[model samples]
Target: MTTILKPLALAATMTLAFAAPALAQDAQPQAPSQAPAEDKTPVTPEAWAVHLQVTDILQHYPAFHSAFQGPNSFRPQATTGNTVDATLYAGVKPWAGGEIWGNLEMYQGYAPNNTLGAAGYVNGDGAKVGRSHPYARIARLFIRQTFDLGGEADDQEADLNALGRRRTKDRVVLTAGKLNATDVFDTNKYAHDPRQDFLNWSLITAGSFDYAADAWGYTYGAAAEWYRGDWAWRAGVFDLSIVPNNAVLTSDFSQFQVIGEAERRFTLGGRPGAVRLAGFVTRGGMGRYDDATALALATGKPADAALVRHYRSRPGAYLNVEQEVADGVGLFGRLGWADGTYEAYEYTDIDRTAQAGVSVSGERWGRKGDTVAAAVVVNDLSSAGERYLNAGGLGILIGDGRLPHPGAERILETYYSLGFAKGMTFSLDNQLIQNPAYNRDRGPVDVVSLRLHLER
Candidate 1:
């Protein structure tokens, strides 16, 4: 499916369509008794609502073009991979001041998983790479609703307006679902290998949304979020019991989990620049009976009978800044720190790490519309304590004292996309992996990548 556009003229018209007067909202008083008031109120229609669209994407990267993705291949290691996915995504104002959002996604094909252990130790049995379920990787679903808790209907009539910091838009979003919660730092770097981010790390795309995550794996809970002024916060209590295929994976004792998060967004300069300071935390143990770690630490009883109780959780603090040097030249930077742990198959402790990176993105060539982006991200785990990598199923320790010093890996990517065209883009990315945790003695692995993308 090669789809081309009619150049800048068509996009100019589309942009105008969104700039209509109806795009602006005006205060209107409610009328008394139209026909007859019912239990459910009919939503008022608006033209701006139609600006929304359904989103979908699918692609592949010949990451490791040499050998089988598995370590068993006597020839060499192959980084090549592909991912097929689609999602019915939408975000629009169905009502005058309220928004509606939802998405259904499908993840299929071949990818790498650190926990599954394909790197060196476990020898790369990655994943079966096909149609799987939520617990494994099929789908997930959740929704949210928001409104003003303060009873004020419109800001024009707001008494707090004179304070310079009156919250014009207020909402409370509730999500009853599960989404990937990968890492505290950069996702574009440590993301799952496949599609645009082929041959990458795991922490990056942890918060990614899935359609059916797996039967027992997805979080079955509800989250409530509040957006006021430039600050937003979310907290939720969920069913922690991971969806298990058999009885062994099920919870033997405790049965739930809880999570909380907050972020503050603000503009730095008078021009086009912004900054975000945020923090997130999640807690509760795996509801499994045979708590592996607890059993390991226990003295007398049979470790199996002791049941490991994971008291681990994850919490992170992050700062993001973006500034536009010119129309086409922009600067971006992000810094963060994360700690704590989660129960995979067994109970484990999570160490802490601090990471930071910067990038530039915008239109160059003295052209107003042509856009390009270049970014690089680095991770520093030198401060973390002894930890384990499901380094494929074979656990390997690196920085923080446990394993060898598999130096930090750095990633750099560049993208060029013409604004006049729809669903058209080209991207080049490279990964400089130094002393990998699994192959500490093998030096570095340089991965070069190319990508073409389309979206409508």
Candidate 2:
């Protein structure tokens, strides 16, 4: 714990030093009204808008019980990891009903074990690839066009990737270009967005949805959305990686994925809530778990899914729900399932998953800018998957040398966030993971993290 504490202290000092100027500039902040008077001003779109955000997370885990270790196993030793990212979001209204937005980001650092050893990895902000020094990339560059369908007008607030504008309640939105599939699908208000809410990979989105993306979680795609009378529908087509879990995206549209979702919104006891059902299918070169295992046994070699890959489709679906049960209190849950026969094309190695959580604001405690949340998730693999893993086959993130005893991976996470200043927050998070990587013999790991986020 001493080694972990030292880096934590240094990180805290560095973050405070970086945030002092912003905190001093906005010393006094006002509480935001729950509902501002509807802006009745004639519908007008902003010409341009700019927003920026920076986030740093430091995570540590103490030594835990482990019967044995493997190449992809979580280290059973005390360790610490950190990640930092800064992003600038700029948008412009190019035409009356169209907007173009771009996100320029710089990122550094890596998660524990280079982000492996668990299906529900600890840090959502951690990327598959990492570097010791900072690097820059255009995370997102997209254009959106809206078509009004005759309904009451609504004022849209200016935020990341969104330009302040007025639009009809019933409208059609079309977006195209490079972005994350989760940005449009499997969204939940209470548990998404690791910078502000739950930080576990399973909590960020449906674990088995396996949306298309490169190693960085972004890909070229197009999406269309329709909203009308408490009902919404969304669909999209996106380019997949050239090969399973590869960092390069397909440039010729040879491999891709298609996704569709339907949502229903309603008022429960006068509180807003919504339910969504989404499904996806990816057409790509992949291998079946059974085939890989059989080939490995026949050849007396370690199982490798990549050795017998062929073009096929992998399908999956999930149900997502979020409800504001009470003032400043929210509940969210997700259930997901995927074709366990084939190797995971993208995302973590989860065949089925269930997640649930709750969040409460500090308004009840007389601190409106504070929040606390807790969540739990369970992940499982199919019989075929189990056999392949036990036979020494490796998936994208998880693959021990062998699996003698298999068990579902279960995780519990909780966090408390303090909004010490406007647009700035500090959070303390902890997670308890049992049967990591579905290996009952490995361990139960405990992880603690500190997070600092600032935005404008």
Candidate 3:
């Protein structure tokens, strides 16, 4: 506990240091003559905007029972990890009905076991790659255009990548360039956004919907959406990594993925709800589990999927639903499945997954800016995938050197977020994982986390 608290204390100090200026500015008293008169004229839409955000997460887990350990197994010892990131979001109206945006970000830190071992990994902010020192990158640079199709107009508020303006509810929107696939697909308002909501990978995204992305979860892609009365349709294509889970992406677009989705919006008992069905197919150089295991046996060695690579296609689909049960309470869930015969391409090693959760605001408790949420996820491996692991095969995030007893991975997570200041929040999260890495012989670990976030 002391080890965990030290870093959190340091992070809290840093946050206060960064926010002191803004807090002081708000406290300054203004002269009577400096107060400007209120304008009665209508406001004009913003031509350009800029936003900034910073997030820090510290996580810790205690040692658990482990009959045996392997190279890819989560260590059976108490440990702690921390990750921090700062981002700048800039956007401009380049033309009527068109906008351009870019995100510059710097990140540092690591996840437990450097993001290995569990299929439903604990931290959504934890990337596959990590460094002791902060590294900068152009996280996103994209263009968006909308064509109004005649419908009631709605006011859009100024946001990270949005300009304060009005747009028709019925429209066709097109976007292209570098961004995270989740920005345009498989999104759920209650469970998405690790910076503000749930921090589990499986809960943030469909565990089996292996979207195209590099190590940092960003890629080049193009997507189009058509929204009408109560329905929307979406389609997109994205470039895949040069190799499965590699940091480099395929620049030539030889290996890629295509995705499609349909969503329905409806009012149920005076409450709003949405359902989405999404599917994806990837064409890339991948390996089959059985083939990899076969080759390993022929060579009298441990299974290695990379030794049996071939050009093939993998397909997957998922269902997502979200409903507002009350003024400040919402429910969300997802079910997903993928082609388990082939090795996973980009996401974690989940072949089948089911998740459900609830989120509630603190309005009822007289703390409108606070929030509390809880979720559970069950992740499984197909027969072929299980056999491959039994043969000593390694996967994107899980492998126990050998699998004598395989069980479905189960995760239960809960969190409470307190908004103490404008645009600033602090959260406490807890996760209980059973049968980690699908190894019944291994553990039921407990993890705790602290998060601080600031946005402007």
Best by TM-score: 2
Candidate 2 structure quality by residue, lDDT tens digits, 260-346: 999999998668999999999999999999999999899998888999899999999999999876667778899999999999998
Rank ordering of all candidates by TM-score, starting from the highest: 2, 3, 1
TM-score of 2: 0.91
Q: What is the C-alpha local distance difference test score of candidate 2?
A: 0.87
Where does candidate 2 stray beyond 4 Å? 1-44
Q: Tens digits of per-residue lDDT for model 1 on 1-456?
A: 011113223333432232222223212343666686555333333322211122122222223223122232212254444444454444444444343434455544443232232121111112223343322232334443445556333242211001111223566655555442321122232122233332233222221111111222344456677877666776665544333112122233244444455555555433355555555544444222224324434543322211444454545555555554433334555565555233222211112222222222222233333444434444433222212221111211121112333333333333343344554444454444433343233324444444444444
- Give the alpha-carbon lDDT of every model: 0.35, 0.87, 0.88
Q: Each candidate's TM vs. the true structure?
A: 0.56, 0.91, 0.90
**Which ranking of candidates, highest lDDT first?**
3, 2, 1
Question: Over 4 Å off in model 1, which ranges?
Answer: 1-78, 90-102, 112-140, 148-167, 178-218, 237-257, 272-279, 284-316, 340-362, 366-371, 380-402, 417-420
State the number of backbone clashes in model 2: 0
Model 3: residue 29 alpha-carbon error in angstroms: 47
Q: Candidate 1 overall Cα lDDT vs. reference?
A: 0.35
Clashes of each: 35, 0, 0
